[model samples]
Target chain A: MRAALYQAAGDVTVGDVPDAALAEPTDAVVRVLRSCICGSDLWSYRGVINRPAGSRLGHEFIGVVEEIGAAVTTLRAGDLVVAPFQWSDNTCPACRDGVQTRCDNGGTFGAPGTDGGQGEAVRVPQADGTLVVVPGGPDGVDEKLYPALLALSDVAGTGLHGAVLAGVAEGATVAVIGDGAVGLCAVLGARQVLGAERVVLMSRHDDRAALGRAFGATDVVAERGEAGIEAVRELTGGRGVRHVVEAVGTPEAWDMALGMARVGGTIGAVGVPHTTPQLGLFPPFRQHLTISLGVAPVRRYLPDLIDRVLAGSLDPGPVFDLELPLEQVADGYAAMSERRSIKTMLAG
Target chain B: MRAALYQAAGDVTVGDVPDAALAEPTDAVVRVLRSCICGSDLWSYRGVINRPAGSRLGHEFIGVVEEIGAAVTTLRAGDLVVAPFQWSDNTCPACRDGVQTRCDNGGTFGAPGTDGGQGEAVRVPQADGTLVVVPGGPDGVDEKLYPALLALSDVAGTGLHGAVLAGVAEGATVAVIGDGAVGLCAVLGARQVLGAERVVLMSRHDDRAALGRAFGATDVVAERGEAGIEAVRELTGGRGVRHVVEAVGTPEAWDMALGMARVGGTIGAVGVPHTTPQLGLFPPFRQHLTISLGVAPVRRYLPDLIDRVLAGSLDPGPVFDLELPLEQVADGYAAMSERRSIKTMLAG
Candidate 1:
């Protein structure tokens, strides 16, 4: 089998790798249908998020189950599914509450030097928990929609869940504080699901902001921190946004998220948190506020999104502006690393 | 009029002061039926919260409307009322939304040389918004319960509102981070209104803990910060509390409040924010959480609490164990400061 492997900062390659099989009794092997480069992937490739040598490089995917362990009951060969970013025993108490990402047995995929997806064929541990059978059938949704469905595996679901967590409501004014695929999806979530009245995308470039508007953003503010705060307040009757979705994982982004919320409004954050060594958050509260943090449980959002797509009410597939053969993995990383594309879809 | 004046951080004394008259068109001059001390008052007494010399010393009180300005319509002369600590017009959007404490025209009593009600008379501004005409025709309920009614002015209502803001609900397990009048009152709020399944009172004092239990705290932990977090987690099956009322204002108290909540829990804080330099509340996202901050809108809560008292179904009067003559204003602070009293009721 061949898979994209990390080499050094700003570099990656498709190389021959060992065969993958069921690593655990609950595990299965999936023949990748579609995979994509994520903003989070840039964190590792840019050396911002440290990665071990020769690690597989993707976590988001939609695939067909090629094989299943004897212990797996719900999944079998020929089944099509979307794998959420986190692997969890969906039966755990946390998962039952729709927070599967924090499940006691929740597992992380695509870590450097570990066996993860992103290959031609990938081993999926806890198959029953990680993979969801895309109800209608494997061919129920077209292949072009697969990458967007692939996005739902992590990015889209994460973004939408972020907005949902932030209490984005119908007719609400929202400010999305990041410009990644997740942020764009949050804009979609805000408008399509939550029915936000207006979504203000905070971005610097024409490209990202364009994607933001296509997703549902009514306005765009190109400011970063303090200025962005002023821009949002100016846009919101001199108060602040009623709901704010923070999709970037940085202290600056966190500040912007908190600052953009009205005195009594909410800030929902979905940026994967980097442990702050100091164990501190500086000046986030201002009299009355509700600050919610953490990664969104993508699994919990899968059903509603799949329904929307199947119903043909919303098409989140436009984020896949570019597509490539899986073998040309190097160009995908370069384009995304240099901010030339919103996201890249890879064909199996 | 004679009242206790806040002259300096540590100097609050009974002295002759100018008469308090109608300060606004919606103002009313109240002949205070009863007045009392609050923990917020102690901040000025300790000089932790700076105030100009000669400010009045009390904010919580029940009174008879002695006079009303032409603009005052909802309240009139001889009408007995339990006025909230902050005078609100109750007509603003914030007030209409039931958060009168944060009303646009709100003004605080006992704020550094201002005419607080720990006196013969005090001016109630925004009378229609701030004063609640105690129900039962004002003549039916016993006047002796005035001290407890006075609590609706701030302490009890603030704590109760904090829990309410934090979404303490029926069958929820609550953790209160302070053991002062407000903290214990928060226990009452949780048990009575929220119907908490279990209440954890963080207290190191036997007397306070006993009072906490009486006030509806189902469990008590004699620990602070991390240890307190451990105790609460242990009590909630090692998951953490579903609701935490942070009645303590310090950063450490805020930390403990965050530490105590389970993922998807809520934290309501109404601890008269002083020395609010920063906040550290990131861990709850892996657990979902809602953190709401603000003092209770007493005017909104007073009518309900008065009903509870009138029905004889609830009694929080035990919290004010000591009753003192208004002349010995210093003793009220001393009793609470020295731990000799859980709450002091100053008779006017």
Candidate 2:
């Protein structure tokens, strides 16, 4: 099987690897149809997050089931499905409560000893609980819908999870920190799912800013730090926003998001933090702030987001600004790593 | 007039002081009928929180309005009232959002230049907004209700705020991480206001533990640190509780509370943090925990709490296990500081 493997910092290779196959009774093998580069993937590329040599890469993908374990009941061979970044047993208390990412016996796609998503084929654990069969069958689904359907695996669902965790409600004034794909999608979720009356996006790039506006951002703040907070406050009529989504996993973004939120407001953070940001207890205490921090339980939001995508009202497919063949997997990672693309979709 | 003033570390004096008078047009002077010692008050008494010489003390009181400035409306001179620990102009955006403690122009009771609640007469800013009028007139409100009414100014209201922020809903298993008056009251709030199905109080003291059970704590955990967490986990069938109220501001309590909460659960923090606790971004992010940290906006919950008190359904009076004359305010502080009493009520 051809798969993406990490070699060293700033280096990746698409080469022959052992084929993925059902290992556990709860596992299934998926033939990769589409996979993409995520912001977190850049962590290892930059050596900020160490990746061992020959490690399987990628955590987001949509594909067709090539084989199912005997124990798998819900999914069968040739079923089109979207896989959340993390696998969970649906019967766990946490999974039942819609926090599949924290499933008691769950694990991530690229964790040590597990098959990764960015491959020709990958073995999925707890296949019956982890894979969501797309409404349409594997046959004749619109090719144009790939990017949008693929987004349900992580990006779109993650953004919506931020909105939900922040308790974004009707007529809320929201500020979305970070203008990455997930941040832009959060702006969309704020407007569509949470009914936010206003969404301010923090962005310095012209292309991303334009994309943010198209995704329903009412205002854009290019300034960083205090100036950015002031800009958000200005847009919110001198009071900060009621809800904020922190999508960039940086200390600066976290601080700015906290400052951008109004007194008593909530900051829903979905960024996978690479740095240990210390939240000083005093300021947030005085402001009565709620910092809802964590990884997005994409599976919890997959059902609703899939419906929204299939309904044609949501076109988050634009997040994929670059596309390449599976053999050019290294190029896909480089494009996203160097900021040459918002996201790169890999066709198998 | 006489007032309780901090003379030095571990030293409080009941001495002559200038009478509280309505200076601002929005101010009202109230004759404090009942005042009580709070857990936070011990910080200064134990020299944990610095206090300037002759600084006025206390922030919880129920009183009778003696005089009102021309701009004061809604509150009359003879009205009986409960004053939240902070004063606010209710018209501010934060106050309108039901977070009065963070009102744009609000101030805490004992802040420099503000009249403290421990005095015989206290000048209250934003009288109409900060003071909740007790339903019955000043003439004949029952003496037995004074302690409960006094509880509303801070203790009971603050506990309820914790429960509310934690989003303790029906069928929730809640764990409160303290044995102080506020924590006991939090147990009550979890059962009464939040409708939590099970309430657990972390207490090592038999007396406090008994009071906790009376306040509706279904279970008690005397262990601290890992053992305490294991106890809670055991009670919840190894999943941890859905709602946690942190009434102790120490970092250890914070960590334990975080550990005790299930994934997707909330930890409502109401304690005045004596130490600057470092909440490292990673643990909370991975756990998907929501840390709702802040001082309780007691004013926001005053009306409903007062109503519950007046209706004879809620009695937080039991927390005040000792009573002292106003002249012995110093003694009341000493008793609570020495743990001789759960809380001490100061009577006029």
Candidate 3:
């Protein structure tokens, strides 16, 4: 099988890897149909975060079960399924509490020994708990919806997690502090699923801003830093938004999220923070702020998000501005790293 | 009239000051019946936080209404009432949202021109919203309950706010990180009001720990630092508590609170942090932690706490281990500053 591997700093390549197979009684072999690059992947590509040379790289995928072990009861061979970014044994205390990302026996797909999603096949552990079968098998669904279904594996579900953590209640006014795929999805989730009355997207790029508008952002602010905060305040009648989704983890983005929240408001941060080391507590403490942040427990949100996508209410596929065959996986990484594409989707 | 004044660092005195009088249409003059020293007061007394010399001291009291301005519709002369530490109009958006501490026109009792609760008489602003009337007048209630009722002004209410923010629920396990009046009250609130299945108190002082146990702490860990965190984890079968109340705000205390929480847990902090400058975000961010903190909106919880006190379901008066007459106000401050008393109550 061929898979994407991290060769070194500023380097990624498609290379032959050992074939994936059912390695345990609870494992299933998945032949990936679609996969994409995440903003977090840029961390390793830019040499900002260290990754072991020749390690497998990606964590999002929608695929068909090629083989199932004896213990896999919920899924069988040839079934279409989506794998959450992290695999969890859903019955653990953490998983039962809706924080599957912290499940006792859970691990992300791209770890050193694990099978990466950006590959020909993946050996999924805890198959019964980790895979959510698409309502219709591969042949029953439209090929055009594959990209959106693949999104359910990570980005869309992550955005919904941010909205849920932010306490985006009915009639809330929210500010999304990033215009990436996840940020646009947050805008959609806050307005469509959470019933937020208004959503403001902070984006300087016209292309991303346009997508955010289509995803339900009622207002857009192109300013950054202090001016961005001021713009968000102005949009909210000077009271600031009651809920803020921090989809960009930069220090400036974090500061903007803090400044744009009203007193007693909440901030939900889903971005994988790479640059920020310490966050001052005094400011948020004095303002009575509630900050809930972490890696999104995407598996917990997969079922509902899949239903929404299959029902045609959500169209997140457009986020994949560039698509390439598995042989050209290196180009997919380059496009996203150079900012030429909002996201890159690879077909296997 | 005599009132407690901050003469300088480590110095507090009772001296003659201007007589209390109604200054605004919403104001009311109250004859102080009971006022107590708070843990936060030590911040200024120790010079950890600067305060202007000769400023009024104290912000928690229960009193008898002496006079009311023309527009004071909800209060009357001779009515017994308890004033929250901060006065708020209650009609503002913040107040309506149950965050009276951030009310548009709210101000603390000890601010320069305002009357301090430690004085013989206090001119309270926003009378209708700042003061919650006791069902019975001063003479109609027992003098023995004065101290308990006074606790509702700040500590007890603040503790309840912590429990609420931590999302304490039926069958939940809670850990309280301080054993001062507020921490003790948090133990009581978590077990009594929030119905937690287990309550753990982290305290080194035997006296405070005993009170904590009486207040419904199922377990007491007298260890400090890493030992304290270890003890708490062991108490919860090594999973840590789902809810933590950070009643002490030093960096060490914050670290203990963070260490004592289970993954995906919440920490509700009510302590007035004086030494901690910044908190490392990576630790909590990776742990999927939610932190909600601020000065308590005591007014929001006053009514319910008062009901609990009046019904004999709560007895926080014991926290006031030292009591003195109005003439001995300086002695009261000295006792609390020297840690000879958990709290001090002053009589008019």
Chain A TM-scores, all candidates? 0.94, 0.98, 0.98
Per-residue lDDT, model 2, residue A329, is 86
Model 1 pairs whose backbones collide: A55-A113, B54-B113, B55-B113, B55-B114, B89-B129, B90-B129, B263-B287, B264-B288
Cα lDDT tens digits for candidate 1, B238-267: 988778888887878877887878767788
Q: After superposition, how far is residue A132 of candidate 2 from its true place, in Å?
A: 1.4
- Model 1 Cα shift for residue B147 (angstroms): 2.5
* Best candidate according to DockQ: 2
DockQ of each: 0.44, 0.83, 0.73
| Candidates 1 and 3 compared by DockQ, better number | 3
Model 2 segments beyond 4 Å from truth?
Answer: none
B1-348: candidate 2 lDDT, tens digit per residue? 988898897889888888998898999999999988888888888988788899999899999999999998799989999999889988988889888888878898877887777879899999988899998867768888999999888888888888887889888889999899889989989898778899999999999999999999999999999999999999998888888999988899998988898888899999867697878888888888898978888888888888898899999889999999888988888788889999998988
lDDT score at residue A205, model 1, on the 0-100 scale: 84
Higher-scoring candidate on lDDT, 1 or 3 = 3
Question: What's the lDDT of the predicted structure labeled candidate 1?
Answer: 0.80
All candidates in order of lDDT, best leading:
3, 2, 1
